[model samples]
Target: MSGSREWLCYTDGSAKPGTGAPGGWGFVVKPPSGSAGPAREGYGKATGTLAKIMEYRAVAEALEVLPERAQAVVFSDNQSLVESLEKKLESWRASGFRNVDPLVVESVRLIDRAMNDKELVVRFQWVRSHNGNPGNERADQLAAQGAREAKADLAVTTKRR
Candidate 1:
């Protein structure tokens, strides 16, 4: 691993575009050198049937599990979520995050905790989806599985991604 900051996290979420259809979120955190114990993956179901919410949930869940004080980049297919994390955070926070999704609020809070409380450096970046990116693809699969199963296994990990 390169120093103590050896993590990159990719996240994605899925939801049927309809009311009450259920949503799923997933994330994969891996070391750049692939030398860590193993890539950690997390997936879970959400009650809302909105991809945006699921996307936010995925990031929130991801930030929750990251190693304390580690520098990492979080990549996502959802541009809005990525922007929210990077660009629009202060404006939203100044307004008390009014009208923001609860999931998003939690995510921003986690980001703050990671930086201020945990001494971590978290950066956000956008990624194009379905372009055969291994980390994103695996997260997509886990999100799909969560959606199909309608499960709530948040923050849990399996051996492989």
Candidate 2:
């Protein structure tokens, strides 16, 4: 239960596009390697958000639950998200996050905060959506459910460590 840790994570986001559209995000965080514990999950739904922003939020929140210094491998179905996290983050920050979509900037700030403040090391990986990957599928299901929850006027649900 104590040592360098690794977490297998997955995330996905759903939205119909356009402003004020129902959007949602979900994430799964498996137990650290060599440990035995229930997987952690969370989902959030809201209007006026985009799928990309939702995806960023999903990863951000999921990363927040990992213990400090834990190594995280985060799998996502969104290429733009993966690229932004892995490649564009530094450049985006160099510009002070100016000229970026406000929501997206906010989401990225959360992600950076989660990583820096928590001292977590994260690796972003892009996975093909609906390719029969169980974690990806599960996250997708949760995201779809979140999107539907927007219709039911539900709030975000999460269990943090």
Candidate 3:
């Protein structure tokens, strides 16, 4: 990938308003040619997961699917996540993902995976949520869809067993 070209990804996560609810994450990647790559999403059954964890998971998922030699910038509405990825990730790794708070450590696996991809150049950018940004809005909608689907799936599973 040319250093001058960059792909953009917008990521978001959603869950029920209260804790211990199903959560979901989604990301939309736009390549340098101004066309969108596939939008990816997933729902998780894990209860009591923080929204921040979901947010990081969205970023991780996006990073995982990016082309190996691509230059990319990921946009997120979560400031802490942006800070952690860009600033604290190195220190967190130095401690082998132990010294960090358990919440931050939840994203360690994804973060480590991203770091290991030497050919992928990725950067994190913060965007205002619920703003007029089209990419962010779509990502948020996708996440909500994922959360709802997850809850419905869980309900169906419970009914069968």
The best candidate in terms of lDDT = 2
Write the residue-wise lDDT of candidate 2 on 1-161 in tens digits: 23247798899988865434788889999977678888899898878767887888889878887888878889999988898789877778778878566778888888888888888878889999999998899999988888888745533332221
Arrange candidates by lDDT, highest first: which order? 2, 1, 3
Q: Root-mean-square deviation of each candidate, in angstroms?
A: 6.9, 6.3, 3.0
Which ten residues in a row are the worst by lDDT in model 2?
A: 152-161
Tens digits of lDDT, candidate 1, 13-39: 898654346678899988656465788
In candidate 2, stretches whose alpha carbon ends up further than 4 angstroms from where it belongs are 1-4, 17-20, 154-161
For candidate 3, give the lDDT of residue 79: 92
Structural similarity to truth (TM-score) of each candidate: 0.80, 0.85, 0.83
For the record, the alpha-carbon RMSD of candidate 1 to the native fold, in angstroms, is: 6.9
TM-score of 1: 0.80
Q: Which candidate model has the greater lDDT, 1 or 3?
A: 1
User: Which candidate would rank higher by TM-score, 1 or 3?
Assistant: 3
Best-to-worst TM-score order: 2, 3, 1
Give the local distance difference test score of model 3.
0.75
Error of 2 at 126 (Å): 0.4
Summarize candidate 3's per-residue lDDT along 1-161 as a digit string, tens digits.
45348777899988775534777788887767745555444334344565777787788777777777778888999997888788977787788888776774766667567757646777889999999999899888877777777677767777898
* Candidate lDDT values, in order: 0.77, 0.82, 0.75
| Deviation in Å, model 1, residue 92 alpha carbon | 2.8
